[model samples]
Target: MWSAHHRRTAILGWLVFVVLATVVGGATGTVTASDDEMGTGDSARATKILDDAGIDEPASELVMVGAKSPDGWRDAAADLSRALDRTGRVTALKEPLPSKDGKEALLRFQIKGKSDDAADQVQPVLDAVDRAKDAGAEHGVTVHQFGDASSEKHLNDLLADDLKKAEFTAVPLALGILLVAFGAVVAALLPVGLALTACVAAFGLLSLASHQLHLFETTFSVMFLMGLAVGVDYCLFYLRRERDERAAGHDAETALRIAAATSGRAVLVSGLTVMVAMAGMFLSGLLLFKGFAIATILVVCVAMLGSVTVLPALLAWLGDRIDAGRIPFLNRRSRKGVHASGSVAGSLLKPVLAKPAFFAVAATALLLALAAPALGMKTEQLGLEKQFGSDAPLSVSFREITAEFPGGPEPALVVAKADDIRSAPARDALRELTRRAGKGAELTVHARQNVAEIAVPLPGSGTGAEAKKALAELRADVRDVRAGTGSAHGPALTAYVGGDLAESEDFTDQLGEGIVPVFLFIAAVTFLLMLVSFRSVVVAVTSIALNLLSVGAAYGVMTAVFQHGWGASLIGSEKVGAIENWMPLFVLVVLFGLSMDYHVFVVSRIREARDRGLGNADAIREGITRTAGAVTGAAVIMVAVFAVFGMLSMQDMQQMGVGLGVAVLLDATVVRMVLLPSLMSLLGERNWHTPRYLRWLPQVSHDEPAPAARPASPTWQHV
Candidate 1:
């Protein structure tokens, strides 16, 4: 109220806050998640051992020298080694090893730097490799490079490009949609502008928070994606309600108050619901999820605050000027609620209201059918081959490297700590371990003092089932070796088998264990919040069920398209055969949270109608129709924004984008528009039922007092 009456103060204060937050965040900078923090299980323990021993694992790279004939590989390998040596970034160059066919030789080397900085520092080395490639091409010898540094560099570039594209594409796309939704340039710009500023402020604040939480590199991208979505959504809801009130012939002040009392209340409830859902990630037991939760929650809070405070103030200051620069036909349609009066929602609602049971049963059955595929859903971490697509240069290089020398790109490491790794007993244990690895596998050991690292080249493509089997066998072998060497009750040497595959597997297991608890936490809290807010057990239970259906349907779609290869070609996405391990849990939390925005807004509107003199069916119809345009606009904007991510090169991101986009689309139309109203109609008065025990819960209402009787306006001009 104060913000609306003192518009100038509110506006200037918001600008100052944004600027200061940005400056402070820039000063604090961000801390990336450390390797130990990112690791899990034995992999994490292995990393801790290595770090404690002051052992630094430099970034390793490999160059495959392939020739038409055997003798050519040695010369090409020699030249590439010299070229790499001249770059000064190369260290510990290993002897060129021959492939099984003897026609390919692999030149292995490490980049001279901290492994984390290797991606940024490897450009000079890559330039040298590129030159080597050009020279080798003249000799009819193919030289391809694949390794941690090169692949990470390429992946980082792809991520940056994708985010930039999304930033440019999503913003204008949102603006254009809002323009159509509002039918006026100024009104359309308001939401977009507020959303953008909120994202900026949240970005700065999150950066500062990163110093304490250790955020992932993708945290900012996720924050921006979510911020723009919810930011615009909240503002759209508030502005539309205020405009509707004015169009109903209330003076500007009354219109603003009604909007604040109604949509403003919905925004608050919805934002809290979203934050609660996002907090479910804290139960995931992974630093990554914790960081993601903080990022999302921060942006939502900032956006929600902006919606309730500055947005109302801006509307008050603009008054009728908010509707200036109106487009002709668009303005007329918006004024007449053309989106609802004869629209699809209206058309569906008629039959749905008339035959509520039939429509309700049918919608429920269809959604359940769609959700069936999720029963077989499987998740795995995407390797370079799948993440960057098979045709990408880095993927091609990795495939070539793995083909020439299996598991050469990423070998499993067995870290053993003993009294003295150089002692005869330790040496025997290590030798026995290698012998048990069998004939086709090659093993090497690097030992210093009491710490030793044994590298085993796993069979088959890295990250494939074969490699996983190899890792498991190696781990078992180490345990046996430790037991054989033990003279006391415990094993003489402490050992951990760790590598990229181990890390991925361990992380996947962690998520698997966390899923049930996290889901239960989110569902329980959301149900409680809804029940208390709506003062109805039926509304709470049904809302949870409907959201679960939406999430399940989205999961089923992702499984079919990404894993089962159903309709994969239609969208230009590949059948990666498994969803990204983190995607399911991440999507569950995000979708459950985001879908509530529309769910709460629509339900609140419906409850408002019911609070008035309207009957259940009438209230359902009125609520769905009246809020159709805004909900559709919000859903479309979210879907469009997420769809931009679906076009990204990374399969995991594609899954996330598709999963979220599909869920929002389903929620807004099928679930929110059809199933919800039909179900409510069938339930009738039971929709608002609360048990006697729960009746003591405080009454929370988004309903505003009936508008006072006033002189009717000649036309809808006050808006």
Candidate 2:
């Protein structure tokens, strides 16, 4: 596939595939989930009832006013009320309802359009509000506009700006790091070019995938960002290998062929591991996780394919020009001998190898310590109040509403669907339920033709303990009321709980239920793959252990920073007081797979040395000495990429960046460089042990040549 003569075919074919995917994706675009698409249980039922009733849930704009008199406030609010009515954007407008304290009042408008598409209707409403505010100021009244539509627009804009900043910042930073590592223009650009094409194609494929599934608007940005980093990483691994082989005096064809066999095979295995890990998130049974898992997996698969095929072909075409325009200080070592400065590897390995128990225990202890905070970790998805900055006027308005109104914007809705809500029996039951609920929370009950809704104002963010406690008591009271009504002979009333807090709790709890099983499944599959690939139970099992430690450590670190608020200000971290519900599971799956990239590469080299009849100790020494440069370079690049994402303002992305960056660094350096060698050294010959029953399995070979003529230096052996 990577034949030197086929360079043009490989390059041109890749270009064509990219173009077609992009065109197809553009034609199809993406299908995003609206509130109806995302909701479940009682919330979902409520949505259906409203839809069946042909009731459009109005996108409301709340105008709160503070002025000298109630009459004066009404007059000021009337300006916005009239402005909204005149703009013709609203289906209806309501008169100002003054608060118990004459200082504040509420005015509401039902904006035009489907609630999901209501952001478009916001601009005109905002324009009207702005004019109304100016008018209120003339009358010595202060007006602040807040609404569901206004909040959505602000969030949409914030996320867009965040992604744009990341794109502009991450690209140059990644390239600069690549330049520093490769120290040559062409060498650096090759990885970047290949990564970009892979991202374009991934986005194309993801667009098509979205229509079949529920994809959040944020999914593509995450895929593209991750694709860029991992794509470049795969290319970097293979390209570095090919360059090394070339420096060892192999021709371009031989170098690339060997890279295909070696780093190429590694990428496939690593990519499979990653995809399998990501696939586990599907079991969480959350549409959001499913979307991210699928999109990320697709992008990784595409990047790996490009690494193996297009990458080798490009190297063949570049030939000597791969090193064209090389930086001055970097080439001298390459011209003489490879930078196989196993010094960092050696310096760390020697003491650990000498005191295996001490180092092993010490390293494990450190990771476990980092992971300690994880035991106390709470998981809840952030609501708008937690997600948005306080600087936004909508956030300020929300605070005011919460201050003036008992429960803020979110109220627990008890929906009862009977054949006829107007029926005497149904009416009596609903009234009793509402009266019982009112004992614990402020309640308003309304009945339509067949459906009755009771709104209970339970304050604080829905995820908070206060809201949960209030909701629990309210539900218990409602159950008691319903049982007392004894509609046993009459039609049974269908009742459900629905609200923002209720939905958040449902999502969090459902995802939590699936996580344990998902973890076991992913772990089992990854272990089997490694065992099959390496033909050693010890290598596979140990790899899993190290990966778990790193992931655990990442969880601990993330929990500490975001949940415990340790050094939170450094990253501009939001104190969400819990890891995002999806984050821990997400980080576990992703980190487990990513941590394996270095583990497999380094351990495989050790196994290859052992195959050449080296002692267990000698093989360990030789393997670490041989691939130290490549492993560390790749690790540094990955860490840098993740750190860039951490620099963004979003809390969820911040948590992800911290987890990934810290874990990868720990996996590459401490786990691989220090603990692995120590543990293997202590275990000695047991490191390669596999059961006799496993001997019948088909043998898999990496880039090992058929008893090749020995190269000048052992550094160029399998490479």
Candidate that would win on lDDT: 1
* Candidate 2 clashes between residue pairs 3 or more apart in a chain or in different chains: none
> What are the per-residue Cα lDDT tens digits for candidate 1 across 49-143?
88888888999998898999976788878878888898899999999999888999988899998998999999998998788888888989998
Clashes per candidate (backbone, < 3 Å): 0, 0
Superposition error at 443 for model 2 (Å)? 9.1
Per-prediction RMSD in angstroms?
3.1, 4.0
Per-candidate Cα lDDT values, in order, are 0.87, 0.78
After superposing candidate 1, which stretches have Cα over 4 Å from the reference?
Answer: 337-344, 423-428, 439-449, 482-491, 706-719
Task: Tell me how far the alpha carbon of residue 408 in candidate 1 is from the true structure, in angstroms, after superposition.
Answer: 4.3
| lDDT digits (tens) for residues 390-501 of candidate 2 | 5556667777766775565767878677776677777777877887777444333345547777878786644478888887887777666656555563656666677777
- Model 2 ranges off by over 4 Å: 1-5, 51-54, 67-75, 130-142, 329-341, 439-449, 461-463, 477-488, 707-719
lDDT of 1 at 122: 96
Q: What TM-score does structure 1 among the candidates reach?
A: 0.95
